[model samples]
Target: MAGNSDPLTPRAKLAVTAGKAVAAASRAAGRGSGSVIGGRVALKLDPDLLARLAQNLDVVLVSATNGKTTTTRLIAEALRAAGPVVSNALGANMPAGITSALAGGSDAKYGVIEVDEKYLAGVARDTDPKCIALLNLSRDQLDRAAETRMLAENWREGLAGSKAVIVANADDPLVVWAASSSPNVIWVAAGQMWKDDAWSCPACGGVMQRPGDDWFCGECGFRRPTPTWALSGDHVLDPHGSAWPIHLQLPGRANKANAASSAAVAAVFGVPPQVALERMYQVQAVAGRYDVVQFQGRDLRLLLAKNPAGWLETFSLIDPPPTPVILSVNARGADGTDTSWLWDVDYTRLTGHPIFVIGDRKLDLAVRLEVANQHFQVCENLDQAVQMCPPGRIEVIANYTAFQDLRRRVGN
Candidate 1:
């Protein structure tokens, strides 16, 4: 949450009242998507609403190209051991959503916010968070986000002046470059699974060598910083050489990496490594991510993958060969209009799995699968796709809005 515990001015109070009214109306009309419209109206009325709301709160901002929402949830869960926390739980990472969340949880003493990468600096500036988690960066929403390097530069500039201690990923070259200059930083070697976005050094534009787990720039002396917190197997190692086992319900190496990063931030706030990991393991799902639901009399596991990097991570979690999987891709506004990134994903890894393609862009995915020499069936609807699979448990992987649609269908 954003605002302080102190009494609000008449103008700010009016804005808050109006925003709540709008939010209530939106929910009554089946449109309350958690601060989409209400937050906008509130911010329009009071331009400095976020700054006012963020006063006296120990805020931790989580930003990344992927996994910000889940990472934010993990941090919030860990922080609950301390006290009440306000967070954007609906997957909205913009200023308006943040303001609305803050306003709703005005009494909370801690705020764990999931911030969009482009707006991280602005939000961090307004909130003055005690800790900021810098997760991995990669190409996402090319139409809106442009080049990834530009974002790295923005993060670098934004974090340079912030007084908050930064918990950064040492494996990500871009993350290293962005948080390198920060006065206080805790580096975590949360294994980099995707290196496609970090071919070149962000500092000198030189080719980066990944001869081993560590990366170094060829032209410049810039290299991956030694991390005090590193992930070894399914455990997180502290500065004192103690390993804490992480047991998260969320599947994939990506979530393990997220847990390690969240543990680092929790440690900064005096939460023990074992306690943080225990709290994180209790998170069965974030919103609809990694949710198991009954759809049309069949059990289905719902997973969301928004881009090439995300898809790569999702594939790693799925059972190989013999398992039937459904992939739904929609080129909606939320999912980005361009599906060109699909080609960059290594669908070849799923060579032997039975993939049922569904959604608006199923044909495009079918073409990719065809080129990869993978076997797939194109179905018209979710029910039909589920019926096509064998009885019992099935896996469903969708992108952004399609995942939301599935969640709605299951009444989640």
Candidate 2:
């Protein structure tokens, strides 16, 4: 604790002690991971506990509509190449989960946190992080969280005078508008797949004009900034114009885009692009995402695509046509509680595949699939759904809760 004048206060220590005990109890109970409950208890004991725990550590917060957990893991892996790093690896992004992560990693010097889009402002305010990464934003959990535009506005106000260097996706207009206000910003051209959310400018409500990869607003002059880093097809280019080919164990084009953002964020923490990319290649899966588990005499590749924006990227990752694809839908609070977002996704992309619908919201998915002129069989649960399909390799795409459910039953 040399050169550290402000150690944890008495109240904060008590809070941490109480939180850890509850967390241990929770883990022993077999109810859940205890990431949220433990941190929630800590916050209740001392409102300033999060700030105090994060005071010594260099923090980086990653936020986006999709890829929050994966990007956070990639960034953490990159940073770990340089030093001991801590993170909420369980896909917990709230204050409670983040606090629990910080509390548990007392020995680590660097902390990379995955933050919920709505909670980013508060976490940034509390943690006083050195860097922040804003990935693409789209309509997700509309019933629970604010629209992408409102989240951008909040991000603008929350990070207005912050001293942190923001590593942002230049390809996303919403991310651009949110991070542009920051004094130090590194723009990375990591492509955006969903354009429906960014058609109108968040600044002036003017129509966004997209000429190739660049986006601009004519009315108020809001535009996509020139990126110092970019993803050109299969490679990621650094600020020095050096192209690095990314060989990741993680799958899909979207994961590659996510890695590009993670490398940029890691560089700010003294981890070079080469070292970052090398370390990132070692991460095979993120919280069971893209993890292929052998279950019931078949290979089940599990993936999470919770919304329209996520679904758009997810479809490209799956095996084409004849592959049996199981689409699991859930409208639980954790999954956004609105099945209308299903209609926003083009179910037609999955037409050629042998589609089997499963989960609590199977009926809702069936209706959307029917409307799209795609034929599908709706099963009540995952086991029955999987049994109905011919078993060799099956592609399973689920929303938030549905993915977690499958991971527990099959992935374990």
Candidate 3:
């Protein structure tokens, strides 16, 4: 059973006071996850209390290595377009964040949350979402989430015997086959040919061979058939120019993929493709990922590379300028403890390394940049890195955790 004491009750005034104090402290500390972080600690200490608070809400659990935040936002937007939506908009994908989002919203028609892959099972078990949007599985957060295969297996075991409406990525042979046996599966396929990244089969651990946009594992005899929702050429307009004339504010192949997936989910909820398309076309750019900003008379493109796959996608879209570059890499405990995934990033794509490498671990990034055979200026201190960057023009590439840090350090 869940906790019985009313958080807002006069008898529980002390708890409410404590929650407010923690919230104030968090704000003073300049951390978004302040009160929510403290709440998570308290909730974990009393599991029943957490369960009681989440009594009758319908949850929409969205889990994926990449695009979780974007998709979650899109879903929430679509639902809001349909009616009303409640969600954690600040990239708080953990249990505590989810709990905080749902704590006092008793009338929420839709509780959409973007969940981290590692904690999906626990969240699902606790909330029992009515619909689960399982985005494509990729190599992300290797240090904490373990290998991709391990996370997939955990998802398989976690969702087993459940009756949740499973929305799986059909283009990803891995996601499609994993949900094959599920009662209700909506498989969404990727439409772009240039957007080919589904390289292997999730089942039987076999290499997949792509035959005309469809993948078939020769050894395991597993292949993804035509998708229920497919976004192909022409339909997927370029960021700059489009045959259909889609003015997508977001850049990169990954953003396009995020758009496609979100549109598919919107359609599943009965939003017409044309209407969803319009909603997407007019949507604002995702705040951090490939979010272009103006700084000191030069166009600053901030690309957040959280994982190896994300980095690869960013590299594909980036056309590095002749000017020197500023690269920031830092892994504080809050950002992410694991940095081993750096080895997986295709750093070799950064062929012509720029002049500056900046972050807490400047030497580590400098070593990664050394492979390009280019000279680099290392600034271990972030403040120094900003001072070291050429004043006239600079391009910045930051990983997941470092994006905020760069923005703070550069006053952007």
Poorest 10 consecutive residues of model 2 by lDDT?
A: 1-10
Question: Could you tally the backbone clashes for each prediction?
Answer: 6, 0, 2
RMSD of each: 1.5, 1.4, 5.0
**Cα lDDT tens digits for candidate 1, 271-324:** 999999999988999888898898888889999999888988998998766778
Stretches of candidate 1 exceeding 4 Å from the true structure: 1-5
Tell me the TM-score of model 3: 0.82
Tens digits of per-residue lDDT, candidate 2, 1-412, equal 1125476889999999888889889999996887788889999999999898888788999999899999999999999987788899987899999999899887788889999998999999999999999998899887988878898999999999889999999999989899988999999999998899999998899999999878899898888899999988878999999998898998889999999999899888788888899988889988888989988788999999999989999999898778999999888989888788888998889878889999989899999899999878988788888899975799999998998889988955
lDDT of 2: 0.89
C-alpha lDDT of all candidate models, in order: 0.89, 0.89, 0.65
Clashes of 1: 6
Model 3 accuracy (lDDT, Cα): 0.65
* TM-score of each candidate structure, all chains considered together: 0.97, 0.97, 0.82
lDDT, residue 372, model 1: 91
Report clash pairs, candidate 1: 1-102, 2-53, 2-54, 2-102, 3-53, 3-54
State candidate 2's TM-score: 0.97
Error of 2 at 320 (Å): 1.3
